[model samples]
Each structure stands twice: as C-alpha cells, then as structure tokens.
Target: MAGDRGAVRRARDWTRDWGRIWGGAWHRGDGTILAALLAAWVLGVSVWPLARLFLEALAPGADGVPLGLMAEVLEARSTGRAFRNTLAASAGSVVIATVLGTVLAFATGLLRLRGRVAMTFLILSPLLIPSQTMALAWIELSGSNSPVLRPLGLAPPPGTTNPIYSGGGIALLMGIEHMPLVFIALRAALATLPADLVEAARIAGAGRLRILTRIILPLALPSALAGAILAFAAAVGNFGVPALLGIPGRFPMLTTLIYQRLNGFGPSVAGQVAVLALILVALALGALGLRALVLSRLSVPLGRGAALRPLDPGRARLPLEAAIWAVLAVIAILPMLALVATALSPALGVALSASTATTANFHEVLANPTIRRAFANSLLLSALAALVCTLVALPFAWLKVSARAPLIRLLDWLVDGPWVVPGTVVALAMILAFLPPLPLVGSLYGTFAILLLAYLARFLPLVLRPVVAGAEALEPAQDEAARIVGAGPLRRILFVLAPALLPAAMAGALILMMTAVNELTLSALLWSSGNETLGVMVFALQYEGNSTAAAATSVLSLLMVLALALALDAMRRWLPPGTLPWRD
Candidate 1:
C-alpha cells in the first residue's frame, strides 16, 4: 500500500511539476552552452597550439624544402640524444620517486612510526617551493666553498669535484622534489587499506616483511604507480631543473631543448620545440592510460570501514621511527638551508665570509622595479585564476550532480583529460587557436589572458574534484524542502547549496592558486613580455646568472605560499559549526 501511494504521489508530483521538467530541458540547453565554452577554452589552450606548432615545423622552407625535412631534423644526432636523455631522466625519476614515496608511506601509515605527523609535513615541504630553488640549493651545496659544510670537512677543498652539475644530480633533485606527491597519494592509499585483510594476514602468521612484500605492495601498487607516472610526466616536462643542472654539462632533455629553441627565437626551431611538446603530451597520455588500466583491475572500493590498522613493530619501532624522521628532516631542511646560504651569499660564487652573507640580496630585490612588478603580477595572476577557476568549476560540478545531460555526465572526464597533456603543448595550442582574424581575442595572444586561460584548462580538474565532493554531500531534498517553504530555485541555491559547498569551493580555490603561483612549465612558455610573475622572474634571473637574487626571490615566493596554505587550513577548520555539509 505504501509503495502504491508513493508511486501515485510521484506521478502527481511529476504532473504538477511539468514546469520543472521543461526547466530541466532548458538547463540541458544551457549545458550545451557550457560545453561550447569549455570546448573553446580546452581547444584554444590544449589542441590549437600543438597543431600550429606541428604545421610550422612541417612547412616548406624558403628554398622549397623537402616534405621529410622536419622528420630528418628530428632524427638528427643532437635531437636523438636529447630525446634519449629526456627518457632516461624521466624513467629514473619515476623509479626513485615511487620507491621512496611508497617506502615512506609504509613506514608512517602501516608501521607504528613515531613523529609521523611531523615527518609527513617535512616530506611535503618541497612542494611548497619551486624546483628551480631546489636546483640552486643543490648547486650551492655541491660547491667547494659552501659555507655550512666548510668547517665540517664535508665541503670539497677548493678544486674537488661536485655532484650538482651531473645528470645523476638532476635526477636526484627531481625525484626528491616530486616524492611528496607520491607520498601523499600512497600514504592515503596505505591508510585506507582494509583492516580485515591485514588482520587476516597477521592471523595467518605472516611475518612483517612478508606481509609488506606480498600484501601492501599489491594493494598499494596502483596509487603508487599513478603517483610515480605523474612524477615522470613532471620530470619530463621540467625545464628549470635541467636548465640549472643539465645544460651546463651539455645534457639536453626535451624541456631544456625547447627552452633553448625559445631563447633562440627562430620559427623553425620553435616549431620543432612544439613538435617535441606534442610528443611529450602523447607520451603522458599513454602512461596515464596504462595507469588507468592497471588501477581498474586493482581498484579497491573505499569506505569508512576500510581504514588501516596500526601494525605494531614490537620492540624495533622506536629505532625505525627515529630513522624515518631523520631521513625526512634531511630531505626537507638540507635544501632549504642551502637555499638560505645561496640567498645570503654575495654572489653565485659562495664566499664564506660573514660580510658576504648580508641581507643585500633581499634589499636589492626589494628595491628593483622588475622584482616589484613580478611580485605584484604573481599575486594578481594567482588571485584572478583562483577566482575564475572556482566560479567556473562550481557550475560544472552542479551540472554533473543535478543535470542528466550527456555533456554534464562527461564534464569531469573533459576537465581531467588535460592532466595527461603537457603544459608546453597546451601553451602552443592556445597560440595556434588564436593566430589571426580572431580579431579582439587574437590580439591578446602573449598576454596575461592566455596564461589565465591555460591555467583554467590545466587546473579545472583540481578545482572541480573538491567541488563535486561538496556538491555530492548536499542532498537534493534540501532544495526540495526549501522550495516547500516558499523559496525559489535561485533563493534555495544561494541560501542552501552555496553555503553547503562553500568550504569545498574555498579549498579548491586555494589549491589551484598554489599551483598557479608556482607553475613553471606552461608559464615558462607563455608568460608575456611585460607580465612576468615571480616564477618567470626566478628562472630569468637564474639564467641571466643572478643566483643570489633568484634564491632570494624563491624564498619570498615559498613564504607566501606557506602563509596561504596555513590560512586556508585554518579557515577549513574553523568553519561555523553546522554550516558545512560534511560536518552534519
């Protein structure tokens, strides 16, 4: 009887709310508009630039170049070597990042390791600073007269060899810089492993090492591999690290090669850079596809009950914990101390005199007009991109939840597809999409707008994921109840849904802003003539050979991001008691 009454009421409700059905249809039409805009932004920022670059590379030369000239150039000795070096670096970085991150995650998550919280924070510290800073720090530390180690007999006396300029050094720095991301992902994966399975393994008399080898590795492999592959992608597209470390040794990766071409400013070479960028993008996609396939097979359903059980390490836990903390501290603090020394030093050549270690670098940077302009531009650009991304992501998330349109259903996939596309390729696509006769928009090429558009395309997924989480937490019945109490759609949304999802939106914005502020690859390729950000300035200052000033600038940027992250964290924690949907 209750089922029959519910069916009858639902039918009557549908009849009475025919206007809503039509309104949903209208909303579907609106979704098409959304799709069109999103498609334009994605194509402009991801596809067109790549196409233009390829076309320019393949175009006939002034003397009627042969059809296969571009291919021949790609096959040339230097290009072949660059490709090989890039692949080798990427593969090495991936292995190191994954292994280190997974081991750290295991020590902290499953084992009863002490100082886990502090160690985790330390491990993630590298993400707060730019890779260029880390490179410079390593470079300074490896110098013969480095201030910190000179008295300890660790610094090479005067003419001793340094590891900082080797490909091995580049790989180590890139791996350490990217390890934090894998740590975060795999740590979560480890923390969320099924307690029941772990307990069953323990009950079966499995030794600690055996359990870790057979159980944890298989279970955590998917996310660990994902993080590792992403690290590879980052390492492959990384220009700053290679420029600082590899270029001096004449070891050219794909990223360094592209930057070299861009600096050369030749049409043919720039087109070849674009071609390389496209190839990198394809590689990124293939890796992600492979990861997705593996993850699908090993996908474990997550829920509240899937939380980890602390695996007791008997009497050996304290020593293990101490070792973990010690390693994490070295990983985090050594580079930072090196950075401080670099910034304090009189010049690139570290003189260990107290007089040389003055605040002049900071003062000079503060007084310089270019530094001031770059700082201001970074703050403005980050703020604008954060706002635009958060706002755009909200409607997209809403459509994903409430609308049944095919476009809405596929919105998340579209937003996330760019993660597999290299930033260089994305920048090139934007340039190609708006070359000429696009009139007003075309003129804005090489402007701040292009950078912002590229950021939106690149990071919308980061913004949308948290938003979708917040949106999903909101029950549709809340909107229905508000309508029952005489509220309209706009009123219910403004008063009910918006407030419910505000925290997620803010979280998304903050994370995206963090990325925008420190983003190197795309911004390196696309930052305009006059609209330089701190990141661009850091790289430029370093390349122009002002290591002290570059280190000072990097320190300033790191402080800003740290403060922002702390403030956002506090905001999330102090939300009004019941305002957040998750709280209820």
Candidate 2:
C-alpha cells in the first residue's frame, strides 16, 4: 500500500512539470503573435495555392486522388519534347554562364586591371535589363535589316531569318542573362579567400599561375558549382527569353508550353498545365539538392584573415584589359546602341542615321494613357510590396533567429518555396486559389490585389534573407537588458532591434523594389487591362509589332533602373559593405 501511494505521488509531480512548460510556452505573447502571422502568411500565400494545384492535378475530376491524368500528361509527345528542350537548354546555358562568369570574377576580383569597376558594372548589366527587353535588343541587333550593323556592312542578308530565333540563340541569351548570378557568387567566395595562404605560397616561390590553379581555384570550386546550379534553375524557369525567342524559333520549353496551354484553353486546362509546372519544380529542386550534396562534400574550413590582394598582371595587363573591354562592348554596349537606334527610327526596318533619327516613338509611348497607367501601376505595386515585405521580414527574421522551435524553422522553409518555384507556377497557383469568389473580396481574378499578393509571396525571401543575416549578427545582450528593465516585446523591438536592422532592411527593400518594378513572368500571367505593368507594356508592344514603341519603353525602363542603382550607390556609405551589388 505504501509503494502504490509513492507511485501516484511521482505521477502527479511529472504531470505538474509538463503543465508548467506548456503554460510558459503558450503565455509568450510575442512568440504567439509571430507564429500566428507566419501561419496565416504561409497558408494564404504558399501552402494553399500549391496544395490546391497538386490536388487538381492529381484529381482532375475533383472526386478523389487519382494518378491517371498525371501519367497521361507525362506520356504526351509534346510534353516529352518540352522536357528534353528544357533540360538541354538549361544545362547548356549553365555551362556557358558558369565559364564566362567565373572568368569575369577572376579578372575583376584577382587581377590588377584598369577600369575594373566599369568592367564589373558592364558585366552585370544584363541583370538590370528585363529579360524581354534583352531578347528584343538582341533581336534588333541581329536582324537582317539591323541599323547598327548595316552601317558597318555587317548586317545579315535581307529576307534572311533573325538567327536569335533558334534553340542555340535561346541558350546563348539565357546564358548571358544569368551570368551575373555566377559572377556574384564567385566574387563573394574570392573576397573571402585567405591572404595568408596566398602569401605563404608566394614565399614558397610559386608562380601566379601555379598558386591560382593549386590553391585559389580549388577553394573557389564549391562556389562556382553552386552558381552553376543557380544558373541552371533560373534557366529552367525563365519565361521571357523562351517566349520571345522560342515561339518564333519553334522551340518550346516547359514554361512556354504552360503559357501556350493556358492561353489557348483557359483555366479549363489548369490540371494539365499544373502537371507541367510540377515538372519545373522538380527540376529546380533537384538542382538545389545536388548543390547541397556537392557543397557538403566540397566545403573546407579556412583561417580568418584578410582577403588576397590583386596580383600584378605584368606584361599581360594591356591585352587582358582590351579583351575585357571588347567583351563588354559586345555584351552590353552594342545591344544598348541597337536598342537606341531602333527606338529613334521611323519604322522597324528603317536604318538609323543622323538624318533618319527621330524621337517620335518616345513621344508616342509617353503620350499614351495606357502606357502612363502601366508606369504608375508598376511603381505603386512594387513600392507597396517592398515596403510591406521589409516590415514583415523584420519580425519574421527576429523570430527565426531567436526562436528554436521546429515550427519557426518549418515556416522559414515554407516561405522560400514560392521563391524557388517558377513564377509561372506561382501565378498558376494564384489563379487556382483566387479565381473563385472569396467570402469578403469576391473574385481577385482580374484584380491588382492578386498581383500584389503574388508579389508579396514571391519577393518575401528577397527581403527576409538579408534581414535574417542582420538579426543573427545582433547581440542578444541588448534584448536581455531591455527585458530586465521591464521593456515589453513591442518596446524592445521598436527601440532596440529596429535601429540595428534598418540598414540591411533598407538595402533589401531597394533590391526588391528594383526587381519588382518591371517584373515579367508573374505579371505576364496575372495582368489584365487595367493591371498592366511596365513589363507587360513592353512585351505587348513588341508582340503587336510596335517595335519602335517597345524599344522606347524599354529604354525608359532601363533609365529608371540606372537611376535607382545610382541612388543606392550614393547611399553606400550608410549601408553595410557589400549591400549594393554595383559597389566594391
């Protein structure tokens, strides 16, 4: 009887301990609020639409789970062709981009080259130009009646097809467009290289070539591979390059195929197209997984030290400098000059000269009410998305770093899903989720609200990533002291954390605004008559054969981007080092 009483007493103590732990966890007001907001955002933005898409794809009859439709879609001949094209183009582009970007990174980051800043900016110009604009510029530059080339007697024969409208052309442009991704990654890795090791190698009488090949290249390999994977994933999901180049070329990738299917058959074909989207998701995720596996094996620890200084190029400097400048001319300056000439010409086929140049195209585009509305809508949407995303990211990042809960970690991964998946998939999911009437907002099918929501979902990671890094670097002691002094959660965040994280948050906001302002892929699928963005306007003008107007619009958008970049450059002193991509 005494033994039984002792057992009951021990059970009561155990139950009380469990209750105390749960009570403490549930009573944390800040954590509870964060959890609730994250849950709502994830469900509304990422989880619901994706879940709905998969459900529809799996069960086209909407009765029960079924795999027959998915299997049938996969077996279709067109689907097989698109799958092959996507893999081939993405792989080819990654190879080209990785090689070019790695070379550029080494030249600018390691060599003592004159005009390195200018060269770096020119190398990264493709990232600022919208993909559609890049395609249009390349087309204009290479067309048979090309004004810029015609003046030099280098134009292709009249009536000859534009060479860029082929599979090889698509791969080349995609490679150029994504080169900046690899450049940034490799440059960062190069910047972190240990100066001590390089100096030690030099002391051992190693030549520049020997040191680079033996020490630096091996250390930078993992970053190069990661960048290649990123380029591949980006190429797979790219819509504008393929749409402008592929359709004319009779080449179709998964993204373009999805667009064609949806445009031709409407949402009635959502299930089939969703299956295509799933394929893209799988490709992107597979690349990312491969990167993870490779990085885990290739990563090595390095001692903390100053980064290596630039090596003297000796007699090779002048020739190397000329080569770099020539590359910049071909990739950036020539295309831009072609775009300008096209914009000034009286008609698409008109050759640009001092006598033939005019500003009528610009005047017409600027005077159009539709164009004006698009500019205003893009500005408003991008600004709101950037501002709201930055605000939410601050708290989300704080919670993510400070909280050790599995739920917070899961939420982080969930938020990244929309970003990793193609914009086409996100747009399709948005359509599936919002096309039907809601309880309060009715239908968001043709509304700007849908675009805004999609932007929020798609670009959240752009802001959140930097903010999380900033938050992780913050000292926890400040928060502890604030709590000790009776400061509430809101007060601590407002007075203590916000000031510290502002620079990173602002930098992220700037990047988000720049990217979202003229976004193409998402806006292409979601835009309606009144909801047109700058990207849609340029694309529509080009597709409608108003090449002059499209060129003018693209030039204006490029100017806007340049202005924003200059503004950020001017503020670099206040921001953390490496915040602005254009800066050293």
Candidate 3:
C-alpha cells in the first residue's frame, strides 16, 4: 500500500510539471495582449488630451514665439482678477480648513469618545456631499426663511444682504467643504505616533497642552500642512461653490471663467480657455510638489511602536465630546435640515410650517420631463462608467502586480495624473482631444461618447486602486496551482483571480458610481443639449431663479448619494477591511 501511494504521488508531480511547462508561455502571451490593449486605451483616453491641451495653450504667435495664447490670456485684466480671487479665496479657506480639521482630528483621533464611528462619519460628510449640494444647503441656512435660524431669530431680514455671497463667504463655505481632507491626513498621522516619544514627553513633567504643543504638533505639522495644501488645491478646482456663490457674487475664478467662456462662445474660445485650464493644473501640481517636499523634509523618522492610547481627559471628557458633537451638528446636520425645509416650503421666501409646507416643489421637479431625463442620464452614465472602469481595472491590476510589464508600472504613475489634477482641467483636455472628428469615431464633441471617454480617463484609477490592493492580498499558491493544472491566463483569471478580486472591485465601482452620479465639474463642461446631468439641473434651476425647485432637485440628488453610501456600508461585513471607509 505504501509503494502504491508513492507511485501515485510521483505520477501526479510529473503531470503537474508537464502542465506548467506547456502553460507558462501561453499565459505570458495572454498577459502581453491584455496589457497592450489597456496601454492603448489609457494613452488615447488620457495622455493624448493633456498633451493636446498644452500644445493648444502654446499656439505660436505671428512673431513665431510659442505660448502666444498664454501671453494673451495673462495680459487680460479678467485673467488677473480671476487669478487674484482664486489665490485669496484658496489661501483663506486653507486657514479655516486647517484649524477646523486639525481640531476635529485631534479630538477624534486621540480621545476615545462615545459613538466615534458616528462622529467620524459626520465629520467626513462634506466629502460625500456634492459641492453644489453643500453650497445650496449653506444658502438655505443663512437665508431669511431658514428653518433652523428663523426659529432662533438668528436669520437676517427678508431683504437684508446675505453673508454667504462674498469672498469671505466663499472661503468660509469652501473651508467646511474641504475640512475632511485635513481630518483624514492628520488622523492617519496621529494613528502612527511613536508611543515612546509620547511617553517620554509625559514623564518629563510636561502637561497636556505642552506635550501637544511641543511634541504632537511638531510631529503632526507636516501632515497638517500637506492636508492644507490639498484643501487649497481642492478649493481652487471647486466650480460648484464658486459658480453658485461667486457668479452671483460677481467674484470671478479660473474655473467659472473657463465655464462661462466656453458656454457662451462654444469651443471657439477653447484655445483661450486652455490657458486658464493650464494655470489651474499648474497650481494643483505645484501645490502637490510642495507637499512632497514638505513630507520629505519635515517628516520625522520614528521607530515602530504600539499605537497611541486614548488620552484620559478625566473631568474634561464629557465637555470635550459635547463640543465636538455640537460643532459637527452645526456643520453637517444643520445644512441638510435647512435644505429639506427649503424644499418643503411653498415659496422661496416663505417660512416652513406644518400647515403651509407642501410637496409641491418635489412634485413639480419629479414631474418635469427635463429633470427626469437628467436623472436617467446621470444614472446611465454613472453605471456605464463604473462598469467600464471595473472591467479595465481588473487586467490593468493583474498585469501591474507582476514584474513582466514594466510599461504597466510606468503607466500606473500616468494613471494617477488625471485623478490628481482638477476635474475642470481633465474636461478641457477631453474637449481638445475629441472635439475634432476622428477616424471612424468622428467628433465625439456634443455627444455622450466624449463624456464616457473623459470619465474613463478620470475615474479608472478609482477602481484600479482597490483592485491592486486586492490582487496583492491574493494567495500566490492558488495561481501557481492553477498554472500547474494546465490553466491558461484567461481561465485562471476567470476561475481563480476574478472571484477573489470582485468584492474590492465592486466597492470601488460603488464609489465611482456615487461620485459620477452627483458630479458637477465634468458634466458642467461636457454635457450637451438633452444631456443635462443632476448637477447641471440644479445649477440651471437655481440660475433660472427657481430656488425652491433647485432645492428639491438638490434634496433628491443628496438622497441618491446617501442611499448608495448606506448600501455600501451595509455590505461592510462582506467587503475587505478598510474598503468601506467609514468604520474599519
């Protein structure tokens, strides 16, 4: 019986070795083909447009000098004004974001509070809320008829000037909108604190404030600044806030100016607008580069240690928790309540009441053919983008994990370029790339194809990131065994690789869908007649002076977003840890 068992084992080993010899080359060929296809798609979809945008901005002058278009744009007073406005607003907002975000991060990251998960979710609410929706909520909050403020007698009179329509207002609101950037960064920095350094500080006769000021702040400053820079970049790219507030406020910004120019004159002014787009991209990139410099220079190397323990504030705990919760309610909960109230009001300036409030605004918005179409379009577009991104991300991640495809590795950096820059810049690049007719795919301009291509370029990285993470976590033995059993690449991927990676891919797709559905920046530029999206619909309704209708539309969009988020949260048990973002 022992001899027979040995013979059977030897026979199995010989079969496996034979299978591996035959299948390895076939698998390599399959990966190469898939990699080549993915490379072409990325190059055409993403790289070409950015290159063309730069070239358009560098159009030669009659005197044969390059960058003539850029020079002309810079000479314009409007350009200068917009540039000044953007800088001032971004800088001011960064200050607010840094202060608020740092306080929140320190509170939540250091102290063990009741309902930490709930508090953290509320703190990061702005990131999930669309910029237009956030702006609308604030507009409702400070309005004369605001439900929250009116009851407290804090709202201004009906005809009094609104405060959320100035440079300071823009800064204040944008600061709140981007606070999560700083919160996330500093939270991560705090989590990695060296236990020894903190203990040493405590033993050296240092009080809470002193340890925080001397040790914690010093160690956390780089992360704080990096988050501030990121917030600044996000503020500069923000169109929804500036468009809703700044346009009416008569404060020009590069993003709004570009939108106005292109919308008014069509693509005829694209060359002129390209220069502004280039500036926006430059500012974002320059800030990111500065962030890299700060992280490299200011970051302190620390030995690996246990995670920092929660601070025992003793008597201060309840008050501290109360304060944090209060601020969160003001920033996160109030605006949403205000928006719902406005939507329920019979008229724009009417006070919401039990008897007076009605569903007329919602009924009208839902009944309108245009808004209904916009909803359908957004749903379809987001779904398609999510579907396509998941499909492409799979092979891209598969090839990326192996060392065989160096180009895949290099292109991985390129993939990040689109996501890192502002959405307005990516939209402009798309217009430049496909506005003109192409072979067999002529003139994607004024069509859904352009939006699809732009979204693929812009959002593919969202899915790719998770898929890559999932791929890295996969057991190598399964893949090796598959290969040894005579499985080809496609078969292995279908049978062995995809099942393990789908949950992560789906999590990412859910993100992409939620984001793309409520997106304003890309849709603002790329959307055409009959292609109006949810963001554009809200902007249009508000621009048309239908405040109640806009409020209703915004409320609906917010519901859709929240629904998607909750769905993902419900699936957290099935998903990989840290993928859902809210809890683990």
lDDT of 2: 0.87
- Using lDDT, rank the candidates from best to worst: 3, 2, 1
Error of 1 at 266 (Å): 4.2
Clash pairs (backbone) in predicted model 3: none
Displacement of the residue 59 alpha carbon in candidate 3, Å: 0.8
Model 2 TM-score relative to the real fold: 0.93
Per-residue alpha-carbon lDDT of candidate 1 for residues 346-373, written as tens digits (9 for 90 to 100)? 7755564676678889999999898898
Could you tell which candidate, 1 or 3, scores higher by lDDT?
3
Candidate 1 accuracy as TM-score: 0.86
Query: Per-residue lDDT for 490 in model 1?
Result: 47
Residue-level lDDT tens digits of model 2 in 62-86: 4443676788789999999999999
Model 3, span 387-434: residue lDDT tens: 999988887777777324788988888988788888999999999999
Better candidate by lDDT, 2 or 3? 3
**Clashing pairs in model 1, backbone N/Cα/C closer than 3 A:** 48-429, 49-428, 49-429
Error of 3 at 15 (Å): 34
